[model samples]
Structure formats: structure tokens, C-alpha cells
Target: MGREIYFGQQELTLKLTGITRFFAIRRKVTMPYSTIKEVLVSDFEAPKWMIRAPGTSIAPLNIYEGSFNYGDEWYFLSFERKEPVVIITLEGHSKYRYVVFAMDNPTKTAAEIRRHLHEVV
Candidate 1:
């Protein structure tokens, strides 16, 4: 599937879709600005033991999407390491604690996300 992340005044939407519209596995995740706790630009590598149960990865296109769990923490990672990614930590999210995604300019994206977070507060 392909990916698109859009930031709005009150929420961020992550849209993922497979090849064609007919054969697409689309997932749209909407996150409220208030739910974000922290945003960090970091280098990420899936752990050796990590597994993506209901996920998809197209290595050639540099896409990796799915869930990774470590002890008490679970993370939803949809990253294409063509560039650096911004890790967004969440509050009271039962599914996953973090969301990691690549952006054209992660530093600026992180700053903008922080700005939205502060706006909500």
C-alpha cells in the first residue's frame, strides 16, 4: 500500500492504500492533536525479534507498515526510510503507544506537530 499523512488544525490523518483502488488495503488513522504527547525525529530499525502480524512491507519501495510490540509497549510504525521519520508518542492510546512515519522534512514536521499540540493546550 501507499501512504499519505496530513496534518490539520485539530487532527492528523494517516492514509494508506494498496496498489489499485480495487485491490487496496486502505487504512485511515485519525489522531487528535491533544492525543500527541511527544514528537521526536529518530533513526529506527525494526528489532531482530520484531514481527508485523497484520502488516505490509515493500522493501523495494522502502515501505514498512505494521505493529511492533516490546514487553509492555506496542508501536504502530508506517515508515519509508527514504528519509528520516518523526516518532509521535500518544496519551491514552490503547492500541499502540507510538506512531512512526517518514516525512520530507522531519525536523520541520516535528516542530509543526508540537505547535499543534501546544495550540490544543
Candidate 2:
């Protein structure tokens, strides 16, 4: 429904399943641990003027999925509601500078990501 986050030996993965994959126009995004700069859980609001180059957005329902661009920065977002989501800030990434997504347990997810990052470093 939302997305699944997986921690691999050298990378972290975000997999969009079911209808989310269709809306996102993407199945999965993988980034090496070195690229992950920070992870946080917060009530993030998608910018009002973001350009959806190849994504789906339903403003009334607050559903946003796929790639977005704003102020010359690339963002990959997959969230269905106005709630707390995990925001992963990345550096040295080829494409996305930020990956924002909603999860069933955003706090736990963020903690796990932090643990993984610590282990990788």
C-alpha cells in the first residue's frame, strides 16, 4: 500500500508495491550507505509548487508518489496521507537529494536506518 524499506549489506532499498508502484512509475530505489547523510521522521509537507516531472499527485487526498523537482533539487516521494514520514537526506547520490516516504512505523524505520548507517560507517 505504502512502501517497504529494506537494509542490505551495502545499500538501502525502498520498494513500492501494488498501486503505489504504478503511481510512482518506479518499483524500487537503492542507494549505498555512504550516500545516506541523515534520516528523520517528521510531518513533511510536499511543496505546493513542486514540479512533478513523472509522478502522480492527488492534492485533495494528499497522495503524492514519484519523482519531483523543486529549486533545482530532485526528490523522490511516496506518501499517501498527511502524516509523519521518513525523510532520508542523501549526498553523493546520482539522482535524488531527498527521499521522503510514509511507512507503517516511521519511527521504527528511521531508527533502523540510523542503526544501519552507524554500522556502515
2-71: candidate 2 lDDT, tens digit per residue: 5888889899999999999999999999988999999999998889999997999998899999999999
| Model 2 spans > 4 angstroms off | none
The deviation in Å at residue 27 for candidate 1 is 1.5
lDDT of each: 0.69, 0.92
lDDT of 2 at 116: 79
Model 1 CA lDDT for position 113 = 74
- Clashing residue pairs found in predicted model 2: none
Alpha-carbon deviation at 92 in model 2, angstroms: 1.2
TM of each candidate vs. truth: 0.74, 0.96
lDDT of 1 by residue, 1-121 (tens): 3556677877887776664211223376677876778889988765555556556666566666776676677777777666678888888775767888776777987888777677767
Error of 2 at 72 (Å): 0.9
Supply the TM-score for candidate 2.
Answer: 0.96
